[model samples]
Target: MAESTPGFELPLLLFAGFRSIVDQLHAELARQGHPDVRPAHGFAMQAIGRDGATASELGRRLGVSKQAAGKTADRLAALGYAVRVDDPADARRKVIRLTPHGYDVLARSAAVFEELRTAWAERLGEERLRQLEADLRTMAPPSGFRLDVAGWFGA
Candidate 1:
């Protein structure tokens, strides 16, 4: 066989690239004054955006247990990024919603992600990055197929 790329295998390269992206994401969050934010919370953050939902609902959406989602919500509450309030239609149940701070963080993080994507576009031409993104989406492994905590987070 002719020589292949003299570097890591494809799967290993993909994994390393993903890890690097997540690392950059966390660094951006911290640099934006969200030191308490974490990769784990990224799931909770998306799940609890805008109108928000019950902890149970969040758990279901994230494919995590209700207890795990509750704990994450608790952490967000403690950080002043989220608040648990009585559900309007059902006082017995609580809903987690993003605080003003949380909304700001969300907006800022979106900009950070754009910056990261732009950097990638610079490395590989914008058109190439667009094709790569489409290819990744088309070839992405099934969500249920993931076995790591990172699986809880979305693309």
Candidate 2:
């Protein structure tokens, strides 16, 4: 009979795999001129989206407090990744929008992720990688991706 894998190793392996990918991504990002970007920033930017969002709206989307979201927006603005502009419809409120630099970082990140996936496929064999992805999809929830992972992890 085949030996069964330890249940305890499953979550560890999964987390390690994720960490490895993220670490590599950040390293590449730094080399590509975005040394200030962090994992949480990516989640925050996704919450901000193309149309931009108010601090409260961003907070809700990211499952973080309004204060936390505001801080993130401040950091992004400082880094030149985002800007806070007057809301057109609501003169009392401000909206945070991704700057061109922010969009460039996101685009670079996507390309880097694709390169990483291709490397993984080459290392594991394309078929095996595809099978692994299929298995993960089958095991994972179908509710779609969430931008709140950073907040979830902090909690």
Candidate 3:
């Protein structure tokens, strides 16, 4: 038998695991009447919950360009999941915040995530999940990581 390369196997397995979890989450979301929700939207929701961010700040944090972040914000706004108000500090920039609906969606999603996480912990044992997290963190790039949509589905 040959040794696998240092970088390939871990990420492959990590993504496979994420796919399983996300599929389960989507099913749960659909049952809860949020069929239109997406992974990117969930990430944006969390970012809004954490802090009021400018689109450029979101772009920097998400490792995307400002234009890409603005597009995401626009979509979220169209869905009534976020609001953009003129930045007090900078007239040219807009501050992004969660609307009431956005917060409600995020709260529901968090509950679902917690339920799933607890079930997984019970099934796999908390120690095992912790170990897996540590191993994956060790393998990740220092700067951070991004899921490229173009490569994600072989598109």
Candidate 4:
């Protein structure tokens, strides 16, 4: 008889898989000339979006404190990944937006993610990979996409 897997092993294995993918992605990103990008920055950039967002807005979207969001913005600016410009609608506010370099990183990240998925499919067999993804979708909540994962993890 086959032994049952422990419940604790499930989350651990899932996280390990995620960590492996993220680690590989970052390594590739560094090789592609974005050595300074961090996992948090991806969430931040998604929150910033194409239109941009004020610190408070970004903080809300990221589920972090305004101060935390401001710090992130500062770091992104220092890395030339983002910029803060005066808000046209609200003269009193500054909106954070991704720089061209930042957009390039996002685009490159997308391409790398596709490559990683293709690699996984090749290794696991396309059918098995598809089944795995289907199983995940069935198990996971239907929350669409969440940008607050960084804050949730931090909390």
Candidate 5:
């Protein structure tokens, strides 16, 4: 990634592994009847906390433009997972909140994550898995990294 030799390295390998894990997790969730939600969608969901968040706020949190965040909000609304309502405090502003179904998706995804972790441990030794997790946490976490359900399923 730096000005160096053009070959495989730790960063690339880590990215590939991250992508693989996310892809597999999505596939497993699909098998268990979760909707066609991608990791990026989880970002919007997370930004829009239970108290709700404006599209501007989501854009700030996601490091994207307001329009981009609005687009994501539009997609969530179209998917019946989110709704944009006028802020009670400020009638001119809009905030996004998850639908009951969206909450269900989050809950189900959490369960599937546990299931996947269990399966991985069963296949590749629980102690090794634990060490791997711990080692990752040991590495300096990048900016905006939160150890939450949605953080595990990152954008």
Candidate 6:
């Protein structure tokens, strides 16, 4: 007998399935009264926190068009989650900084993520959770593989 390819392990399908589950989780967040924030907002928040960055810089980091990043910034600004200030180093550029409310929201989101992760671990059991984590880490590219629980659980 020949070695068989594992069924349902196609990378794209796996990613899509995970995405659906994430969508459900986000829906729960929204139901819990989180302000209808998109995945893009979460990505933008992470980028801004990592680097005191300009919108164009965020666009570059996210592999999105500058206009798209600007639009995202606009939404954040309108929601009072961020403000764009003239960059001191470069007059031509502006940097996006989180507002107090944004920081609060981010902190709450962190707590929620921790709670969810703990619940998930409880459901999966320690050994199975560890195995699932290891498998996912192996699948990720070397450069993208972040071993930190924060990165794994996306807080």
Q: Which predicted model would earn the best lDDT?
A: 2
| Per-model root-mean-square deviation over C-alphas | 3.9, 0.9, 3.8, 1.0, 5.2, 5.5
**TM-score pick, better of 1 and 3:** 1
- 1 against 4, candidate with superior TM-score: 4
Q: Which stretches of candidate 4 lie over 4 Å from their true place?
A: none
| TM-score per candidate, chains pooled | 0.84, 0.96, 0.76, 0.96, 0.82, 0.77
Each model's lDDT: 0.82, 0.95, 0.77, 0.93, 0.79, 0.71
Q: Let me know the TM-score candidate 1 reaches against the reference structure.
A: 0.84
Residues 1-108, candidate 1: write the lDDT tens digits.
988885758878888887888799888889879988887777678877678889888887677878878888999999988999999999999999999988878888
Error of 1 at 121 (Å): 0.9
- Point out where model 3 deviates above 4 Å: 1-7, 137-155
Compared with the true structure, what per-residue lDDT tens digits does model 5 show for residues 27-70? 87677776578888776787787887898888777777788789
Runs in model 2 with CA error above 4 Å?
none
| Candidate 1: count of backbone clashes, pairs at least 3 residues apart or interchain | 0
Clashing pairs in 1: none
lDDT (C-alpha) at residue 115 in model 5: 81
Tens digits of per-residue lDDT for model 3, 47-149: 5555678987777666567787788889889988888998888899889888887887777877887888888899999999889778878987886655333
Global fold similarity of model 2 (TM-score): 0.96
List the lowest-lDDT window of 10 residues for candidate 2: 146-155
lDDT of 5: 0.79
* Candidate 4 lDDT tens digits, 32-84: 99998999998899899999999999999999999999999999999999999
Q: How close is candidate 3 to the true structure, as a TM-score?
A: 0.76
Per-residue alpha-carbon lDDT of model 2 for 110-146, expressed as tens digits?
A: 9999999999999999999999999999998898778
Order the numbered candidates by lDDT, best leading. 2, 4, 1, 5, 3, 6
